[model samples]
Target: MGSDYSKDNCVHKPPMDERNLQGLKDYLINYNLPDGHEGYINILLYGMVAAGKTSIINTFFSALDPDGRTVTCVPTGMDPNSLTLELKTYKLAKLKFWDTAGWNAMLKSHVKPKELLRMILEGRIPIGTNLQNFKPTFPEEYPVIPGNAIHGVAFIFDMTTMDNISGNIMLRFQELQTIAAQICGHRVVIGTKFEKLGINEKNHAWIYEYKPLQQKFEQLSASTGLNKQCMFVVSNQWNGEHITMIKRILALYALENMIRNIDRSLKMTA
Candidate 1:
């Protein structure tokens, strides 16, 4: 199905210009690295299965690619199961986006919250670990040191299915947020599948201006202690039209938030 709104029908926000993109790239290139580490800014994207994390990565690259060709560095599909089994990292200049296996209630046993927290904090996980037959490994067993730790975490959510944020989901979010806070990293929530929300181009602004949607995110932000500005509503489905612009805007917002968080951490420590 196509998006309910088109770029022409919505309020126009300036796209991320080349200058801004280059500036962000340069900033990340010189971003501070932990002692004895040799990695640049690494952002972790985590969310439920089929929440469009991979799609967001692909769309973000597509927006930045000068040739306007969509890049599929990470595999994306509508599979009921998580397509990503191991930790996969996608790099753009000095910024690296680490895509991990989707979090689902059914696979909690295979990939527990604590295990995921350890992987994120240490920034390394056993290669080729799938949901089935996955075993939590001790640090001794996985002696590999990560080049960098996660600087920011983005939680992707499918807005179409967000009618009820169950207690289990909230608990998972809280757990992840606690880990992020302990490491001085930041967390942002990205809501996808916006097209299914019945918002068209004429009222696309409502996505942000509407009180109900804003309140829902605000409640989540309050519960998780994330900055209110960290919440974003995005549509990553490429409908071969103005949806591309929408995706670009969302990607730009997400990147800006990540950069802001990293800068805040640096300032706090400095």
Candidate 2:
């Protein structure tokens, strides 16, 4: 769900001047909307710590690897509180999700996140290393792909928290959007912890009503123009009901937008 990475497209392509190069660099670095693949939607999960980012991953792809043993060593036990010291990729249906520990994780490590991000933008890291043992510490040292391949970024938030009332959430969201715009030109916000939202007979034990939260989200969407892109009330533990709904929505999102680009690129121009 991104630009074609064919060696020919990278090589032999005309070089850009500094401005154009910077523009391309911005496009390569930010969060992207899925736009050009049929069989795959490359997504990165990002959110504040303790927001249940990994939990969603566990819930969706648990069938593939039951114990979720792979991410156990990342940093925190059952969670990576700070850094994504390790990179793990999972494939489901036609989409691939690259679960990135929130950018905050870079704080504890000696490594600079910006440098690591820059390397990803430039596409210097080797692709397809064994994720089971690969440890990412420094920018030059981490095993990552050369050039940016990420097509989408999923920003997960805890819907149960009233943090939306604080101005900080808006500020942070704007900053993240700006960064994503600079890097990949687009980003998607995902509201998680919906299990705590209005519950149901199948999975009905929620603590709070999410009507207020939905109102806040509506405001957020209007401000960001991400109304259609937003995913609300996601509960990973549901009886495959809400989860299935979200999956279908995400699949349609990727298929309609990202896959369309791939088809266009592959089409024979008359």
Best model number under lDDT: 1
Report the CA-based lDDT of candidate 2 relative to the real structure: 0.45
Tens digit per residue, CA lDDT, model 2, 1-270: 112112321211222234433333233223233444234445666665566666666544432222222222223324325334355566655556666545545534444444444444334444443333434665556545523355556667677774543575556455655555566423566666555555443322111222444454666565455643344433444443233333323223322343344334334221
**Model 2 poorest 10 in a row by lDDT:** 4-13
Compare the candidates by TM-score and give the number of the best one: 1
TM-score of each: 0.77, 0.54
Model 1: per-residue Cα lDDT over 169-190, one tens digit each:
7787787778777763677888
lDDT of each: 0.65, 0.45
Error of 2 at 70 (Å): 17
Candidate 2 off by > 4 Å: 1-40, 62-84, 108-148, 162-173, 201-210, 222-225, 239-270
Q: Using alpha carbons, what is the TM-score of model 2?
A: 0.54
